[model samples]
Target chain A: MTSVLGPLALATSTGALLIVPLAPALRELISKRDAGPLVTRKDDGNISSFAASLRTRCISLHRMLDDCAKFGDNQLIDLSHGSAFVVGQSGAWAGSHHPVALVACAGSVELPAGFQSIADFYCRGNVRCGQQSIFRSLLSEEEIALGNDTQVLRWVHAESSLSAGRNCRLYGRASSAKLLTLSPGCSFERIYAPVIYSSTEGTALNLRTEYAPYARLAQSGIGRTRVHGAMHFPADEEHRGDAVATRNIDLEQGACIFGSMKANGDISLKERAEVHGSLVSTKRIHISSGCFVKGPIIAEREVIIDSGVQVGLPGTPTTVSAPLIHLAPGSVLHGTAWAKTEGRVGD
Target chain B: MLLGLFTAVVALICIYTIRHYCFTVNRIIGQQRHPYVDVDTAEWPPVTVLIAAHNEEAVVGDILTALLEVDYPAEKLAIVPVNDRSVDRTREIIDSFVVHYPGRITPFHRTGGRAGKAAALKDAMAYVNTEIMLVFDADYVPGKALIRQLVAPFFDPEVGSVMGRVVPLNVGKKLLTRILDLERSGGYQVDQQARMNLHFVPQYGGTVAGIRKSALDEIGGWNENTLAEDTDLTYRMLLAGWKTVYENRAECYEEVPERWPVRVRQIMRWAKGHNQAMVGYSALLLRSRNVSWWERFDGLLLLGVYMMAPVLLLGWLLAMVLFYLGAPVGGGLAVLGLAAFTTLGNFAAFFEIAAAARLDGSRARIQLLPLTFLGFTVSAISVSRAAWQQFTSWIRGQEMVWHKTERSRVAPVVLEKSA
Candidate 1:
C-alpha cells in the first residue's frame, strides 16, 4: 500500500498542478448556454429606447450655428447652396444669390444690387425691394414694396396690400387690396405658374454644386495650360506671360502677375502681389497680406486669405469657392464666397 | 520510471513542435483571403464608438482627438467615452471634451462598479444606441479611415464582429517595443489573415474592433467575470452562430510598453486571461455544433497556447533529471530528430515575424529576429508564473485580482511631439 500510494501521490500532485488552472474553464464550458449571463440585470436597459432618445438630440446643420456669434442675432445669412429659412421674426441678409424663405421678418430684406430675378421668394413678412426687382412668386403675409418695372411670373398671394411701382406685370393670380401705379401694356398670362416653394426641413444642400462648373472647366483646361517647372513672377517681371505650373506656384514678396495664373497644386502669394486675372489651383490657394486678386479665385481644397488681402474685382461680383475657406481679420471679399465647411474667420 | 518520464516529455515537445511547424507552413502556403465587399459611403449605418479609459489621462486626449478627426459623417456618429473611476485628470479631460462637443461626445462616468475593463464596458454598453459599436483602447490613435474600413465588413449580414490590425507607434523607441512590433506583425499579418482566409476562427482584439450591437445583446452583452472579455466575446459570438472577420486595411497605431517589466506584466495578464478562457471554453469548443471539426481543432490549439509554457518547462526538468540519473532518454537518432524538430518549432515564430516584416516593406527590422528569443524567454517565465497563480487561486476558490499596467508618464508627450 505504501509503494502504491507513493506513485499515486506523485501522479495526483502533478496532475492537479496541471489540471487545476483549467478546471474552472472546463466547468464553465460544460454548463448550460445561459448559465452565465453576459450582462447582469443592473446593467441591462432598453437599447432601442435609449437610441431613439439620442437620435432626437442629434445635431443638425442649423443647430451647428448655436455657438456662432452671427446666429445670436435675428439675422439670417444664406451660407448654404439652398435657400435659408427664417423661422421667426428675423432680418433676412442674402449674402449669396441663393433664395431666401421668410416665415416672418420684423426688419427689411436686403438683396444684392442689380438682382433682377431671384430663384423664388416665399415671403411671410413685409418685404421692401429696390427698383427693377423681379420676383417669380411673392407669397407675402403683410406688404411688399417693389420698385419701378417689376414683373411677377407666378401667383401673388398678399394678405395685406402690395404697393408696386410703374410698369408691373402680374402673370398669374394677384390678390391684393392695394396695387400701386399701373403702366400700359401690362398683360396677365392665362397659364397659372405653379408656386415653387423649396423645402427647408431636410439636410442642407451640397455647397459643392456651386463650384462644379468651375471644377469641370479647370479639369478640361489642364491639357492646354502651359507647364512650368516653377512659378515666380517678380514685380520686375509683371509683363511675363501667364504663370502656370503643374506642381507648386510660389510668388515672392511684391511679385505682380499681370495675367491669369493656374497651378495644379498649391499657389502661395506673398505680401503686396497684384494678380490682374483669375488665380486657380487644384489644391490650396494662400493669399498673404496686402495682396490683391482682381478676378475670381477658385481652389479645389482650401483658400486662405490673410489679413488685408483683397479678393474679387472691385464693384463686380466675383466668387471664391473651395472646400475650406479661411478669412483673416480685415480681409475683404467683394463677392460671393462659398465653402463646404464652415468658414474659419480668424481674429 | 525515469525513462518513461523522459519519453513522455520528449513526445509532448515533439507534438508541440510539429503543431507549430504545421501552423507556420500553413501560414506561408495558404492563399486564403477574406471575401471582398464593396460598401458605399451613403449606405453606412449609424455607429456608436465606446472608449473605456482608466487613469489614461496622458493618452486619452490623443485618441479622442483622433476619433473626432475620423472621416465619418458627424450626424451618423456618436462617441461615448467611459471613465472607469480614474483618479487622475482622465475624467476632467473627457469632461472638457464633452463640454466642447456636446451631443457628439457623450461622457459615461462609472463611480461604483467592478474595477476592470469588462465591467466598465458593460456599463457603457447600455448607452449604445446604434446598431454597430466600435471600441478603441485609450492608448490607440486610429487612422482617419478606421471607422470607414472597420464598418465596411458589416455590410455582410453574417459578420457579427470585425477586427483591425494594430501597429505599434513606438516601434523604434527601444528593443522591447521593436520586438513587440515584430510580434504584432506576425500575429496580424500572417496568423490572423491566414486564419481568416482559411475559414478558421479569427480573433476580435478588444481595441480596434467593431461589434454588432444586436449580436452582443443576444449574448447578453459583455461578460464581466472573464479578464479577457475580447476572447470571451469572440467564442460566444461563434457559438451563437455569427461570423467574425479580420480587416487588414483597417490599421490603427497603439503604444507598446517600452520597459521590460511593463511588457512582462502585460504579457502575464494576457496569459492569465487566455488560460482562464482556455479552461472555460475548450470543452464547449469541442462540443460546439456550430463549428466544423477543423475549426474545433484550431480553437483548442489557440486556447492551449498559455499551457505550452508549463508543459515545456516540465519537459525540460524531466529531461535534466533523467540525464543526471544516467537514464537513457531516447535512442540517439530519435533524440536528435526530436531536437531538430523542436528547434524548428521554436524558431517558427521568428520566421513568421521575419516574413511579416518583409511583406510590410520593413526588411531592415528583420535583423532583430534573434532578439525575439529574449522576448520569448520572458513570456515563458511570465506565462508559467501566471499559470501557477491561476491554479492556486482556483484551488482556494478566489477570484483573480486585476493588475493594471502602469502607463508611461512621458510616452504620450513624445508621441505628441512626434505627431
Candidate 2:
C-alpha cells in the first residue's frame, strides 16, 4: 500500500505540471467575460474621472443601490440618501493618496469657540493618551467663531472600548498653546482628564466660492472629502492664451459656471442662452436657424476674414471679431458677436 | 428475444428510410419546385376569399380593413365572411364593413342548425362565384400582395391547392408565445419546405390556403366527418390526381392561441381531425388505380406513422432495453434511428424556422428559437391528446368541439386621422 501510494503521488505531481500550461488561457477567457475599458479623463467634465463616468448615472438612491449591486463596483459612495458614508479600501493605484478621505455635509460645519483653525480643534490639553480615548465636547464653528468659549474635551479610559470604536485620532496644534518639543524624560499620561478650550480667537468653517484640486483629496478606504461650497475657475482674456488648444468642457448643470464652454474660436452665445460646446468665433460668424450649442463659443475680437458663414465645427464654434466683416444678404446671427462698437461689416 | 428485437429494428430502419425517401422525392418534385404551371398576374383569375370567423370582434374589423386595402382590382376580388354565431360584436363589425364596402363585400351569417366550421364554410361556398377560393381564418392577416402570389401558381393547370406561409402574431408576449412562434417557424420554414424539397409536401394548414373553387365543389366542398377538414381535403385532392403546391412567399400572420389551455384544445382538435383523415383514407393505400403506387402506399404509411407515434415511441424504448442487455447490437441501431430523427430531420426543421423567422424581418421573434424545444414538447402532448380523443371519440361515438383560436388587435400600418 505504501509503494502504491508513493507512485500515485508521483503521478499526480506530473499531472499538475501539465495543467500549468492551461492556466493562463483559462484565466484569460474568464477575465474577458466581465472585462470593461478603463475610465479616462475627457472633454466632458460632468464625470471627469473615468470610473465615475461609466456608472449608470442613476439619480434615485434605491436605483443606485440596485445598479451598484448589479454592476458589482469595487467601491460605492452612498451620498444619495443623505446619510453620507465612504466605502471600500482607501488609497490610490499609486502611493499617491486618493482624493476623498472624509465626506461631510455640502455646506458649512459649526465648530466650538477657542479653536482658531482645523489644527486647533484637534488638539486640547494633550500630553499623552491611550487607545480609545473619548474626546468629548468637540469644538464647533458656531461657538468657536462667536467666541462662546464653552466647549471642552474629555478623554475616555477603557481597554476594550478601542475594538469597535471609530479608531480615528486628530493631530494638530492648538492656537493658544506654544509648540512643545518633548524630551526623552518627559513622559506623561492622562488617566481621567477633562480639558476645556478657552480663547478669544476661534476657527469657523467657511463656504468658499472656489475649491481647487482639493476635491480629489478624498481617498476611498480612508473616507470621503467634500467641497462645502461651489468651486470656481477664474479666467480672463489676457491670461487665457497659455494653451492654444482648448479642452472640451462638460458643464455640470448644478455647478452653473458662467463661462462654462470651451471653444477654439471666440464664443458668442445668445443672451440668457445655454451652449454645450466651445465656441470659436472667427472673422466670419454665421448662425443658422434652430442650432443649439450647449458649450462655449470662441471668436476673434480683432480683424479676421473668412467666407464660411453659419458653417462651423460641431459643438460650439469660437467666434473671432474682425475690424471689418462682410455678411451675405440673408445671414442672421443669434449668439454674441465681438466687435468694436456696433459690430458688423467694416466695424 | 434480443435477436428478434434486432431484426425488428433493422426492418423498421429499412422501412423508415424508404418512406423518408419517397416523402422527400414527392415533395421536391411536386411541392417544393414549381410543380404547377405559372400564370400571368395580368391574366390572373378572379378569387373569392372565404373568411371563417367565430367571436373575432377584436380583429374582424382589421381583417375587413386589410381586405379592403388589398391591392387587387375591386372587380376581381370578393370577400365572404361566414360569421359562426359569434356572441361578441363580430357580426356588427362585419356588417359595418359591408355597409362601407357596398358591392365589394358579401357577409354570410350562420345562426344555427348544425354548427361547424366546415358546415359554415359549405353554406358560405354558395356566395363564392369565382374560379379560386382563398380561405383565411379570422386571425389571418393577409399580405397586400398575397392574392397575386397565391394566384400566380394557378397558371399551373394541375395545381389543386396552394398553401401560403402562416406566421404567428404576438410572438414576443411571453416564453410560451415565443416557443409557439418558433414551432410555427419550424413548421412553415423547415418542415413544410423540407417536405416540399423531399416531395411529400403535406396538407396545407387551413389559414392562407387557396383551393380551386371548381375542384373543391367537385369533391363536395369540405368533409364535416373529420375534425381536420383541411388535411382530409388535402389528401382527397392529391388522391383525385390534383397536385398540392406550397407557396412560401405568399405570407399571412395568424394570431396564435397564447394561453396554454386554448393551445391544448386547438392541438387536440387538429390531432383528432388528422387521425380521422388517416383512418378514413387508409383505403387509399390498397387502391392504386387513380394515384401513383408511391403516393398510395407512402400516404397510408405516413398517416399510419403519425397515428401510431405513441406505439412507435414505446417500441423504441423496448429496443433500447434489448440493446443494453447485450443480446444483439440494437443499441447502435437505436442511436442511429434517434440521430436521424432528431439531428438530421428535426434539427434541420429547427434551423429552417430560425432562418425563416429572421428572413421574414422579425428580429424579436427570431430570439424565441431557444425555447423551441419546450414548444415541441408541448406540441407532442397535444398530438397525444389528439390521438386519445380520436380513440375515445370513436369508442364513445361522440364528436368533439371545433374551437376557434382568438386573435389580437393588429397594429394599423396606415393611421390616418379624420379630416
Candidate 3:
C-alpha cells in the first residue's frame, strides 16, 4: 500500500502543479497578440459618429461607382436589394412603384409630389424631393433640397448644402458641410453645418464677447470656499468659473458667466444671459430669448432654446444636445443641435 | 469575543464583495454616462504636462517625445519634466531634451525642500503658468487625443480634477505584467467607469490625470506629509465638494512592475499611502454635509480597501482559535463562513476582471482567470504587511518613506502614435 501510494501521490502532486500553472502560463506567454493598440479619436463615442461613418461610406462608394455607368434616362434601374425609378429631366417620377431599401441615383433626380419612399436615396449630383415626400434617408454628394412638408425618417446628409422647406419633419439627423437652411415650422432632431439657419427670420447675432470682467473661476474664489463648497455665482458679478448647484441655477437677466454650469435640477438662463461655456443638467435646461451660450448644452430629459438665442460662435462651434429639444424661432446654432428623441421648431 | 470579531470581519468582507458585484453588474448593462465625451472642437486651455521622474533615466525621453507629438496646440502646451532628486542620468537626459526642443521642453530639477513626488510637484508648480496641470509618471506613454479627452470634463465648472485610464504597455513581458494588465483593465474599464456612471467619487490616481490649478490651490495643493499624495488629494477634493471626474476613453500606457519584488514594493507603498489617507479622511468624509449619502458610503468603502487585508487575516486567525476552543463553530454558520472564505473571497474582483476582459474584447486572455489567485496571494500578503507596518508606525510615531518601485525598462521606449 505504501509503495503504491507514494508514487501516486508524487505523480498527482506533480500533475496538479504542472497543469494549474501551465494554463495561465501558456495564456500569458504564448497567446496570440490579437488585441488592437489602445487609441482614442476625437469622436471616440460621439453620437454624430454614425453620420460621419455614413459620409465615409459614401466616399468609398463614390470611388467604387466611378467605374460604373451613369443613369442615361428615366428607366427601371435594378439594384442589389430592390429597384429604383429614374426620374425624368422635368423632375417627375417614372416607375410604377418600387419599394426598395436602397435607391442609388447616378445623377440628379426629383421624385413626384406626395411620394413616400422608405429607402436611403443617394445622389451624385444635386437632388430635389417633391412635396410631402417621405424618405428613409438622403445622402447627396453635391446638394439636397427638400420640398414642403417632407419627412425624413432617419438622417439626411448633403456634402455641399441642404435646405428643408416649411412644415418638414426631420426625424434623426440633417447635416451639411457648407450651409443648412431650415424654413419656419420645420422640425428637426439633429442639425450639423458650418452655418445653420434654423428659423431664417433673424440675422446672426454678435458672438464675440469681452471676457475682461469674467476672470478664471480659479482666481475669483479664495482658497477656502474654492473647494470646500459648491459655487453660486452672484448675479451682479460677471463670474468666470464652473458652477454646480444641488437645485435649480437660475441666472438672472444680463448675467454673464465665462465658465460652464451644471445642475441637478433645471438650469434657467434668463433673457440676455450669456454663458461662454457648456451647460449640463440632470433634468431640464432652458435658455431664454436674446441669450448667447457658446455651449455644448447637454441635458438628461429636455432642453428649450428661446428665440434669438445663439448657441455657439461662428469660428468656434459647440453642440446643444438633449433627449427633447425645443427651438423657438430665430434660434441660431453654429455647430450641432442633437435631439435624442424629439425636437420641435416652435412650441 | 472571537465570534463577534469573526462576525464583524465577515460582514465587512461581505459588504465589499457585494459592492464589487454591484459595480460589475452596473458596468455591464447600466446607462453609461459619458457627458463630456463629445466636446471635440474647443479652444483648449493652455496646459502644463508635468512629468514626475525619480531615478527614471531609461524612460523620461520616451514620454517627452510622445508629448511633443500629442494632438494639442503647440503654443498652448508646455512639457515640464520634474526631476525629483535622482542620482542617475534622469536630470541629464531631461536637460538635453530641453536644449533640443528649445521653448517646448522645460525641466524642473528639485534638489532641496523635502523629497517624494508631492513635494517635487509642489515646487515645480511655482514655475508653470498654465491653468490646467496634467501629471504623468516618467514611464507613461500617452495617446494623441489624451490631453483633449482629459481636458473636456473641465468645461463643466463642477469638475476640478480628471483622471484618465492607465493601461499597461509592457504586457506579454512576463506573468506578473499580464496579471497586472488584467487587473488594470478591471480597475479602469469597469471599476472607474461604474463609479463615473453612478455619480460616485472616482479616485484620481496621480498619473494619467490632471487637476485645475485653481482647485489644487484651494485644496491646499499636495499634502507632502502623506505618502500617497494622490489618494490624499482625491479625498480632500471630495471633502471640499469638488468632483474628481474619470475619463475611460482617455487612455495612457505605463510600464507595470515585471518582477515580484518590484510589484510587492509598489503595492506596499500603495497600501501604506491608501491606509494613511483612509485614517486621515474616513471620519471627515462621514461628517461632510450636503454630499449625497451614496458618495459618503462609497467614499468610506474606498478608503477602507487596503485595511481589508489585515481584517482578512484576523478572520482566519479567529477561525483557527474558535476551532481549538471547541466552540459552536458548526452548522450553517460554518458552511457560510467557509463558502465566503474559499468561494466568495476575491470573486468580486475576479468577476470584474472577467467582465472587463469581455468588455475589452480580449476573450483569449480570459483563459488565465484561474491563475489570478497567485497574484492575489502575493498582493494580500504584501498589503497585510504594509497595513500592519503602517498601523504600528502610527503607534510608534514614525513616518513612512516614499517607496519607489525600481523600473525594469533597460532601454528607452519608442514613441508611436496609432491615430
Docking outcome class, model 3: acceptable
Q: Which candidate is the best by lDDT?
A: 3
For candidate 1, lDDT tens digit of each residue in A52-167? Answer: 33223222323433333244344355534444444333354543343453222333465433445444454445676666667766655567655555677655545454544444
Question: How well does chain B match by TM-score in each candidate?
Answer: 0.93, 0.83, 0.97
**What TM-score does prediction 2 earn?**
0.49
Indicate the worst ten consecutive residues by lDDT in candidate 1 chain A. A193-202
Where model 2 places Cα greater than 4 Å from the true spot, the runs are A1-347, B1-40, B197-199, B293-298, B301-305, B316-348, B351-370, B408-419
Winner on lDDT between 1 and 3 is: 3
What CAPRI grade goes to candidate 1? incorrect
Give the clash total for candidate 2.
Answer: 98
Relative to the real complex, the DockQ score for model 3 comes to 0.29
Q: Candidate 3: TM-score?
A: 0.84
Could you say which candidate leads in TM-score?
3
List, residue by residue over B182-281, the lDDT tens digit for candidate 2.
6666566545665555445356667788887656765677877667778888788877656567876566766677678888777777777777778777
C-alpha lDDT of residue A244 in model 1: 56
User: How close is chain A of candidate 1 to the true chain A, as a TM-score?
Assistant: 0.39
